[model samples]
Target: MTILVSGKNGQLGHCLVDRLNFSDLDYISLDKKEMDITKYDETARIIGEIKPRVIINTAAYTDVEKSEIDKKDAILANESGPENLSKICKKIDTPLIHISTDYVFDGRSEIPYKPEDDVNPKSFYGMSKLAGEQRIQENCDSYMIIRTSWLFSEYGKNFLKTMLKISKQKKTIDVICDQIGCPTYAGHLADAILKPIKKISENNFDSGIYHYAGDQECSWFEFTNEIFFVANNLGYIEKIPNLNKILAKDFQAKAKRPNYSVLDSSKFCKAFGVNPSNWKESLPDVIKSAVLA
Candidate 1:
């Protein structure tokens, strides 16, 4: 089967490439330089040339804080670009696997955000991604919109890498303890992306939105502390410091992030007949790989 992966350099894209290396699938992966989805003509041309049975769109403008000032660029990349890709996929009648985020919800609930929950984005970044979801739903018929959260990987600059860097330079670091969500490893997300595609090819399954993320959730402070603890044990860090806990509002940012962006993965698990490992269990491999790198 011919499958195309966009955002080849991003966290999930990189993970997908590594995971699918030994699979019997013809995959064409492209970074932004190879195919810019922002241009509809370019997107159409590339999709037509590749003729992929499934198009996995991992590309996104993910700078939450910076998006407040760069709304135009954010909208172009997040909303308009996905729309273009959806249109192209629709034209060819190929199934689209688009990645979305938990930020589409307002983060006000005590329970996890379900797939059928109402969307009330609190930031420009969230709004832009939500717009992308809307565009894809309207334009494409055969598509799987997966809403994930707190994605990190060894290939790119992510939260785990940032904390490790900060720990190396400073004796202490302050992280928000109030905001709670899963620290989804990109490799796990890559696996989640592949599951439905295999199902589609084997069973000709119907398409819809699903939430795929790490099994458990935690605050930013807890997640950071775990990173440093693992790093110190793995000899990646010399010593651990006082990890300070702060509230989300204490950290000044241009964008207003969701306070509780945790998503319910029950729907995804049921659809694929697989339950992903929790973040804590899967985090060790990510740390091990990052340490080795």
Candidate 2:
């Protein structure tokens, strides 16, 4: 079975490449440079010719701050791209696995967010992603919308890398404590994505909107402190700096993030039999790989 992985240059896409390299299946990885997913005709012409058995879309405009002003890019990549992929995949009778985000929720609830919960996006980024999800559901029958949050990894720019860089430059950093969400590792999410692909040939293949994130939730301040703790233990840092907790109002971000976007991943675990690891437990390995021992 041929699997086409879009957004090969991204953190999740890079991890998927690492996973697919070891697998026995036939696969092709392409970044936006190779395939502009927003171009319907070009995307349709290319993907229709290939006729992949499965199409996993990881391409997205992820800059939360930039999305506030750069609506064009965000909508093109996050909204139109998925729509194009879904339509082409549907035409070719291929299973489409499109990654989504927890930002789709308003983050108003105290409890963890369920897959079927009402979506009320707070930011332009969230709105764009939610639009993508809706478009996929509307156009494609064989589709899986997997939503994740607080993603970090060894590759590409992300919160983990940003915090580590800050620790090197500053003695203290103020992170928003009020904002709470799960920290999903790219490698883990990449692995979980494949489980569905493995079962795509089966008649009982489950496909729908699913939530998959780290087992536990923490504030950005707490997450940064944990990163320091793990980095110190791994000898990446000479000393653990102070992480001062601050409210969201003080930060003044261009985009509005939810206060609590922790997704309830029970449904994803039940279906795939793949439970995500805790954020704290997974921190050490992430630190070890990115930093020199």
Candidate 3:
């Protein structure tokens, strides 16, 4: 059976491509340059030709700040693109595995977000993604929506890389401590994505929204501290910098982030039978490959 993966250039997509390479399954990954997901006719034609049994859609407009100004493009990618894909998937009777974000919540909850919780997205990016989820629920019968948070990996631009670069340049840096969430390694998430692929084929899994993230949670400041810690161990940097804690507002970000966005992924573990990876344990490899190398 063939699986089609969209957004090949993204961090998750890159990791997914790598993970799928070691597998026996036949899969094809596409980036926007190859396939504009917003163009329904073209996407439909491409999928028709491939005739994939499963579609894993990681495609999204992820720029939180840019989405505020570029609502049209963001909405198109996050909302309309998924809907169009879902419609085709529904018609062909192929199951869809869609990647969503923790941004769908406003970040006010003291505890982790459950799938059934009332959603209140504060940003356009969050709203658009939530819209995509709603659209998929409405249009597709067979689907899995996996919501993740603070994703980082060796591939693509992410916080880990930013911290590594900044740490090397500056002896001291400030990181936001107010915003809290788990830093999901894309490689771990890629593995999680595959855990259910076989189950999907066996028809043992049901269509529903699930959360998957790193095992532990922390603020962005703590996450950065861990990055420097790993980086120092990996010998990427001679010394770790002093990281001063600051509030989210102190950081120059256009988008408002949730104060607490840690996702409760117990449901995913219950459903997929795979436990979440510990971010600290997973960081060494990422630091070696991306930061040190």
Candidate 4:
């Protein structure tokens, strides 16, 4: 089997490339230079040429705040890119595994988001991603749109790296306490993606949206504290600073993030027959890899 992955340099994409560890399948990882998925004709042409059995699209305009002012770019990458890829993958009778986000929910509900939950996106980024999901469903037959949240990895820029950087440079930092969600490790999510592929390719599985992430929900404050603790334990920093807790409203941003977008992965676990580890347990290894000794 030939696997084609887009956004090869991204946080999740990079991990997937390094850790997939499959010897039987040939992997073709593409950065922006290899293909600009925003153009439908070019995207379709390249995908049609590759004729991959599985196309996993990880590309996106992921700057949540920037998306507010630059909705066009967000839509182009997140919405149009996936739409084109889905159309081509469907045309070739191939399976498409598209990465989505938990931001599609409006953060109003206290309960964890189900796959069938109504989406009322409060940000341009979320709206664009939701559009991508809709496009895949409309354009494809064999598709797995996986929605994840608060993703971090050893490679690329993410919240964990940001917090580590700040912990080293600053004496004190303020983190939002009101916003609660899971911090999903990219490796776990990437591994989870493969299960569906095997099931779909071998067992003739059903196709739809699935949610996967690190188990356990936490606030930004809680997550940062844990990150610093792990970094200190791993000897990444000489000292850990005081993390001040602040409300979400106090930290103004261009985009409105869901306050509690933690997804219920029961459905995904049942369908895929795999469960993710908790963030606290996953953080130590992540810190060991990304942070210094």
TM-score of each: 0.97, 0.97, 0.97, 0.96
Per-model lDDT: 0.87, 0.89, 0.90, 0.86
lDDT of 2 by residue, 1-293 (tens): 78999999999999899999998978999989789999999888888777788888999999999999999999999999999998887787888988999999998899999999999999999999999999999998988899999999988999998899889999888999999999999999998888767687332577689999999899998888889988988889997777888999899799999999999999988888898846677788888877642
Residue range 1-293, candidate 3, lDDT tens digits:
89999999999999999989999988999999887889999999999999988999999999999999999999999999999999999888889999999999998899999988889998899999999999999998999999999999888788898888888799889889889999899998999989889778545687899999988989988899888877787788898888889988888887887899999999998888888767888888888778543
lDDT of 2: 0.89
Q: How far is candidate 1 from the true structure (C-alpha RMSD, Å)?
A: 1.3
- Residue 80 of model 2 has an lDDT of 96
In model 1, which regions exceed 4 Å deviation? 201-203
Candidate 1 residue lDDT tens string, 1-293? 88899999999899999978877777999999999889999889888988888889999999998899999999999999999998998888888888999989998899998889999999999999999999999998888899999998887889998888888899888899999998888888888778668666433766778888878889999999888888888788889978899988889877888899889999888878867547777666788787677
* Best first by lDDT, ranked: 3, 2, 1, 4
Candidate 2 clashing pairs, residues 3+ apart or interchain:
none
Give the clash count for model 2.
0
* Shift in Å, residue 179, candidate 4: 0.5
The positional error of residue 34 in candidate 2, measured at the CA in angstroms, is 0.5
| Model 3 lDDT, residue 14, Cα | 94
- Residue-level lDDT of model 4, residues 33-151, one tens digit each, is 88888988877888878878888899999999999999899999999999998888877888888999999999988988988999999999999999999999999998888899999
